[model samples]
Target: MDPVRNPYSPGAGRQPAALVGRDAPRSSWRVALERIERGRSSQPFVLYGLRGVGKTVLLSNFRRAAAERGWITAQVEAGAGKSLRESLGETLHAPLADLARPSAGRRLLIALRTALSFKASYDANGIWNFGLEAASAPGGGADTGVLETDLRKLVHDLAAAAEEEGVGLAILIDEAQDLAEEELVAICAIAHAAAQDEWRVLFAFAGLPSLPRVLAEAKSYAERFLYERIEELHGDAASEALTDPAASENVRWEPSAVKLIVEESAGYPYFLQQFGQDTWNAALEAAITYDDARVGAAAGRATLDNGFFRARWDRATPSEKNYLRAMADDGDAGSSSGTIAARLGRKPASFGPLRANLIAKGLVYAPEHGIVAFTVPGMAGFIARQPSTD
Candidate 1:
């Protein structure tokens, strides 16, 4: 096998050669885009799932599709900053500034300025005019610095500006579960106002399974936004993810070999790519075999250990590491806090801070009240292999 001809790319946020098992979300999203473009009220979107479930890939694909349709689009990550205002202002400035409709562009700019003013962390000059001869002043209504009150007006006015420019504005935000309560409310407010005014704008977010809870806490009308679960690929889709790319380049996967990798990967997109890449590298001929898959699976697991799981493992404090090891010993899915605490020789209540800290680090999450689980797929196996600290 030629490593140079390897078509499989397994990395963070890397798009699979063939995106599989996403017809439902993609079709629904196509309709949502059209609905927003036509000024028809449609639910905002939240694609919630586990980490590495391809939420970012799906969001990026949607943003790319919107851009292809000439929609004004901005993609930003949540939790990288204190507030979303600065990142959004920076994101929207480029697209809106180049719109060629000065009046409409100014409205967007004014909204941006209003948002930017609240982000004192953003230097005044950091928000550039993009060489456009501009005279837009910040509007009083949007510059109030009250997130709930002002964000609605800002996004509403931006949608109006988009309408004027004969385009629509859509933002794709990732890691939405990390958004502050006020930030989430401000976002919900924008959507609420958009629905009332029929604004030609959309906001789509991608986050972990707990995103619904976060959104529900932010606004009572959170159900107005449709949530899609991006689970792992399935039988046919999973097979295609492994076979199609290989077939494209004159490499053939043996049927049993394909089944082996797909079943081992549990239809997860990342694992599919990882196994495919490793299997391709391990095979001696054009045909990938079950024997090759077995070797490749071992190689891929080692790779994930040093890269995927190791990164998270390194981030844990010694006590946190022990906590994860205990949880890992319990099972693959989730463990009760009581069980993990018992493993660590402590009462459940005494481990509250540690559990919360692990969740905060994104290494673990509470699937239910008092139940903890690893955020990454196959993490429990990686943790279980570690020598116990206790």
Candidate 2:
């Protein structure tokens, strides 16, 4: 087996060789795109899950699918210290530029002018030359210094331009939970109006498990948004995620070996790819064996410890580490805020800042009212393996 030809990819937001166990969401997305193309409105899709559960990967897939259909697509991530306006403005430039021409439609010219105004909203010193005369066009009020007013105008004009081109507009946001309150409200408001007015635009958001609650808190109408909770693959889907990639490389996995890796990885997509890669490297024969799987699982766990889990663990302060250590007692199911405080021999209110810090660092998230869990899977075991800092 050659490591150079390895088909498994195990990085943050990396698309795997074989993307399994996501047919439902993919099919829904296709239908939504078709509906928008037919002048029918569709609800926004909200994908919420733990880290490494493939939310970003799936969102990327959605962007690709829309782009393939000639939809005006912009995919962005929040919480990178940039506002939604800035991120969206930057990402939309390339596609819009590709669509710009001298004979562009009236609506397209208007959209270009609106986009220029949106760009100016964030970067006063910067400008976009779409190589078209959009100055005399009708639309340019998106630089009002108000998030809702500006975003609505931009999306409306762009959606109209998309419809004129016989396509649709798609806007996707990853890490939606990190978006500012005003940003979230503006997005939800525009999406709601889009649906009511039958605008040819589609929206998708992906983030941690708390994303649904965050959206609902931002706008009560978000309750009606289509929410898909991504989780680990199960049974046959999990097996296929590993086997299909190996098969494509003309390699085979013994049933026992596949079962061992699948069970050990707990059907998580990231863990499966990691274990699969290690097993491929460990296999000396054309076919993977159970013994190779054992060695690979060990290697994969070490890699995750030194890389995935350890990176997040090291980001915590000593106080935050103690708080995490206390939460580990509850395993990956999450821990009560009061319980963690009690374990640390402090009042719940006193530990509020610690919990908030962990959440802000994306290491932990509140799944419910008072229960907080790791954003990454298997984090409890990783924390338990760490040497005591106290």
Candidate 3:
């Protein structure tokens, strides 16, 4: 065990040393992959949940497993500070290159040539070939439209080749909501094309709470075509993530502590991982046995004060902030859209967009019609600290 490690990482995008709370989901996720491999569930899948919910890490692990299973995998994160079309093109091309057979190098070059036109530039080899051009504007004779077409064609071809050669293709997109509506549609269209061609190209995406709705809005057939949900681990499953892995590492978690952590996390993998890490860190720090009190103390107030939590805080406009303050003072975690609007001194109708925005940011979760509450546990404590009268 690394004594200095602070396992409770709460950053915008942090990767784990080893995924501690993911063992349970693997079985069901494997079923999904097997279905994709057998060409049973070919539609894109959207995995979504509140921020810091470990959806991203699950997707990464699933992608690695898919690759190891002989599936060609392409990973694209939608919010990595790039245009969706550009990122999608690059993502599609990488897997085509990766899974290309040695004999298919010519086909890959031809596809690239057909997609991009380069200037005549000579390298040290003195092989006067066309220099690679911009993907969007391949200099010579290639059209931007052709790049799009060639990309789709290339993926379909790759999938077909993989199938013939006894492999599969998997495309995993995280933070998928950041993708432009048009690009999402285009990628789905490509997936549809692959399906028509009997090519096994599967997509798995993870994003904020609104992701499924976004996809549904983009394509009416999205709901019918995809398996979408926040990845969940049940009691036994959650126990496996904590106890089984620890046992392998020669570390042990008291059953009571594991049960408490599972209950607190609500089976959310990221929370489970965070709590386990914090408990471990806490135990190490105090040089004491890993007891509930010590672990809980180590987690302290910052357990949920994560990047996701801060993001919700940062999303509040001055008026929204005032509304939140009012709610906090009233001992309310959230308000009805109309009530929030009224408190903010705005017309109720104008609150629709703001409410949607808030929901998408994962600060609030809708429990029933017209009712919302903080998604993060114990957020009301932080809200109480804010000056409500401001």
* TM-scores vs. true structure, each candidate: 0.92, 0.99, 0.74
* Displacement of the residue 208 alpha carbon in candidate 1, Å: 1.0
How does residue 281 of candidate 1 score in lDDT? 97
**Total clashing pairs for each candidate:** 0, 0, 0
Better of 1 and 2 by TM-score: 2
CA-lDDT, candidates in order: 0.81, 0.95, 0.60
Q: Sorted on lDDT, highest at the top, how do the candidates line up? A: 2, 1, 3
Q: Tens digits of per-residue lDDT for model 2 on 160-268? A: 9999999999999999999999999999999999999999999999999999999999999999999999999999999999899999888999999999999999999
Residue 201, candidate 1: how far off, in angstroms?
1.2
Per-residue lDDT tens digits for candidate 1, residues 158-252, read 67666766767788899999987778988887887787778988889999888887888789898878999888898899999999999988999
> Which regions of candidate 1 deviate over 4 angstroms?
101-121, 130-133, 136-141
RMSD to native, candidate 3: 5.8
Clashing pairs in 3: none
Q: How many Å off is the CA of 230 in candidate 2?
A: 0.2
- Candidate 3: lDDT of 324? 58
Ten contiguous residues minimizing lDDT sum, candidate 2: 381-390
Cα RMSD for candidates in order: 2.5, 0.8, 5.8
From the highest TM-score down, the ranking of the candidates is 2, 1, 3
